[model samples]
Target: MMPNTTTLLISAGLLLARPISTLAQTTDPNVDNADTPFIQNIRPDRPGQTVTTNMLHPGQVQLETGILRFDPTDASWGTRRTLSSALLRVGFFNHIELRASQGYLHPLPGTSVFNEANPTVGPAGFTPLTVGAKFLASTNQDARSQVVLLTEMTLRTGDASFLNKAYEPAIRLLVSQQLGARYGLEANVGFRQRGFQAADTKLGQYLGTLALNGPLGGNFGFFTEAYTTWQRSTRFLPGLTSGLYWRPLPGLRLDVTAGQQFGNLGTGFTLGGGLSVRLPK
Candidate 1:
C-alpha cells in the first residue's frame, strides 16, 4: 500500500535522526572540500509562500519571478491574476543581502488590491516600492541549521489604486534545519501592518509557516508546505501547497505549485509557476 504524506514525513524524520557519530564516520574532509565552484546553486523563494533561509553568496544577484492565478470563492469577483510577480536580491557584505519585490495584480471590481480573502497578494503599481534586507544570524555546520532575519518596509508612493498611502513595515524570523543529506525542514514566524489607517493599525497580522522539501532524484525535487495568518480578534487562516521543481542548469531553476486557502469568510485555490536565475559577479 502507498504511504500517506504523514507517514512519509515521519519516516524522513526517523531517517534524519541517525546518530551524528555514525554520519561523521563516513565523511572525508579532503574529498568534501576538493571542489569549490565559482557560483553556487540558485536558491529560490517561490513555488510556496514560505521564504527560505538560504542567503546568496557575496557579489551575487538573483531574480525569481512567476505568474499566479487565484480562484476566489465568490465567482462574481472572477479569477484574480498576476502577470509578473518578481523579487530581486543582491548580496552585499558577508551574510547580508538587499531585496525588493513588486508585482502587478489585475484590477478587480469592488475588491481592494490586497484583501483578506487572499494572503498571497503582491504589491502593484510602478511607484509604490517594497524593499527589505536579510541577514544570516547564525549557523551550525554539524547540524546544518541556519537562522535568518528579514526586515522590510513598503513606501507609500504609488498609484492611488495600489497605494496603502502609508509606510508598512514587517519582520520575520526564518530557520532551516537540514535533515540528513537530501531533506530539509523550514519554518517562519512574523507580523506586519497591512495598512496605516486606524482600522488596519489596531492589530497587525501574524504569520506562521512550516515546510518540508527534498530531492526526488537527479534533477528533480519537491516541497510541501502549510502556512497561516491571524490577528488578535480573528481565527487562524490556513493554507496548504505542494509543488515540483527542476534544475536544467547550474544557476537556473523552474517550478510549479498549486494550493488552497481555508478561511471563515471565504476559501480559494492558487496556482503558480516561476523560474529563478542566479548571476555571478
Candidate 2:
C-alpha cells in the first residue's frame, strides 16, 4: 500500500523545516545551500470525475481536453454532445496550482427541451466556466502516495436559460496510494453546493469515490471506479465507470470512458474521451 501523504507530509515538512528555520535565525552561510533536486511529478485528469492527488512542478502546464463528449438523452431529441476543455492546470510555487475549465453544451432534446413532468426544468448551457485552485499538501515518492485538496467556483456567466445563474462552489480531498508497480488505489470525498440562490445555500451533494487502476503494459493503463452520491430528495445515487488510457509519446495521453447510473431512477449512459498534454517549465 502507498503511504498516506497528507499524514506523512505534515510530519516530514515539520522535521525538514525545524532545522532550516533554526539555521535561518543564525548567521550560518550554509543555510542557503539546502537546494534539493526535483523529481518529476506527472498526473493527468480525465477518464473519471474524481481528480487525483498530484501537482505539476513549478512552471509546468497541463491541458485536459475532451475531443467529443456525449450522453444519451431520455428525451427523444437524441444524444447531448460537447467539445470542451475539461480542465487546465498551471503550477506555481509553494505546491499550488491554478485550474480552469469550460464545456460547450449541445443538447439534443428527445422530444422537448423542457422536462415534461415539470416545464420549469431545463439543461445547462453550451459554456459553463469553472475556475479553481489545487494544492498539494503532501507526496511521498518512496511510498508512491500523495494527497491533494481542490476547490472550485462555477461562474454563472453562460447562457442564462442553460444555467442555474447562481454561484456554485465545491471542495474535494483526494488520496492516492500505489499498491505495487502494477496496481494502485484511490479515494475521494467531497461536497458541492449547487443551484443555490442568495441566502439559500445548502449542501447539494455529498460524494464518495473509490477506484483501482493498473497498467495494461507499457504506456497503457486501465481503471474502474465506483462513484456514489447522497442528495436531498434522491437520497443515494450510484454510478460506475471504466476506461482505458494510452500514451503514444511522452507528455501526451488519450483516454476513453463510459459511465452509467444504477438504480430505479437510472436513465441513460454517458460516453466521453479526453486528451491531455504536459509542457515543461
Query: Best by TM-score, which number?
Result: 1
Model 2 is weakest, by summed lDDT over 10 consecutive residues, at 32-41
After superposing candidate 1 on the true structure, give the runs of residues whose Cα lies further than 4 Å from its correct spot.
Answer: 1-40, 72-79, 107-127, 139-143, 195-201, 265-267
Q: What is the alpha-carbon lDDT for the whole of candidate 2?
A: 0.69
Candidate 2 off by > 4 Å: 1-42, 67-83, 107-125, 139-143, 195-203, 264-267
lDDT of 2 by residue, 114-183 (tens): 4546454445455668899988877432235668888999987765545346678989998887654446
Which residue pairs of candidate 1 clash?
A: none
Full-model lDDT, candidate 1? 0.75
- Deviation in angstroms for 178 in model 1? 0.9
Candidate topping lDDT: 1
